[model samples]
Target: MRKSRYIAKEVLSLFAILVIAPCFAAAQGSEQSDKEVKQMIQTQFERMYEKGIQNLSDRIVLTGGVKPFAVVSDTGDNVKAIRIRQAEEMPPEIALEVLRRSLIALVKKGKIGATAIFYTADNPNKKSNADKVLVVEMEHIFGPTLAQLVPFTIKNGKASYGEQVVVDMEKQIFNIKVDEESAE
Candidate 1:
């Protein structure tokens, strides 16, 4: 009876180790991956600063008496995640007014969720940072959403600005525009 009890204890111990070891290893790997991703994001921001993308480091203050709004996410991080650092909520009319003043467009109606200063890192699935592009995608909603993607790149320790990308949602196409300041 004692011998059987000892054998049972040994079997339980073995089972615990077999089950937990892989989980422990996987947790450690996940922590390492998170650290790597955070480091990559920091490096990309520094590169954007060097490239004279002033928007990356600048503090944007909205004019007039409007207060800032809370940020919200539309979806989960399936591909890449856009982080909104500052935002302001505006009614449809007020949003349209702001958009028109910024030369975006003139419209009568449609809710503008937020006027956001946001950015998204390039796909981290890439093996190296050299293949990455960090983008600031600002959207001002009038009657429709007008989105802009300002891409910044770093390679061989040199930082530079790429073409400004604009997507036409109605047409489901992207348009590249030259950033005059960066082009200089």
Candidate 2:
């Protein structure tokens, strides 16, 4: 009876090593792959964020106020511009809302790596650093959503921009969703 019990214990140990081990290893591998994907998306978000800021700055320098617009990067890293047209009767806030909706729609239907939306506004708080700020909202489909308030001044069609202040934003683009099934 003691020998039979010992054999049973050996079988259970073998079961754990051959079956449970791979399951645990695969879960670990899935987690690692998720991290890698998030990191790659983060890089794309950063690149597109910078591009959005530059585009806004250039427009402000030339036009004093900016038309809200978007920039998107695809999975292949191809970048493109999307201009949001505002109605003559529309306020800046209304224009911004229109742009936001357009950006969200694009993210949902496109094979997007990252996307950013840009608009200019008077700094909401007087205690804040600058009187004027360009609002840049950015997102990565599998990563994070961020809002950057970029301080800047324009003179002689030249722009001088300060370091941007970043804040965590609610995801409206792709809901920052990644397919866990695929990860598994």
- For residues 24-76, what per-residue lDDT tens digits would candidate 1 score against the true structure? 54877767654543443333323322322333323222221222121211112
Go through the candidates in order and give each one's C-alpha lDDT.
0.31, 0.63
Best by lDDT: 2
**Which clashing pairs does model 2 show?**
none
lDDT for residue 63 in candidate 1, whole number 0-100: 24
Error of 1 at 159 (Å): 2.3
Count of clashing residue pairs in every prediction: 0, 0
Top-scoring candidate (TM-score): 2
Q: How many angstroms is residue 69 displaced in model 2 relative to the true structure, after the best TM-score fit?
A: 0.6
Summing lDDT over every window of 10 consecutive residues in candidate 2, give the lowest-scoring window.
Answer: 1-10
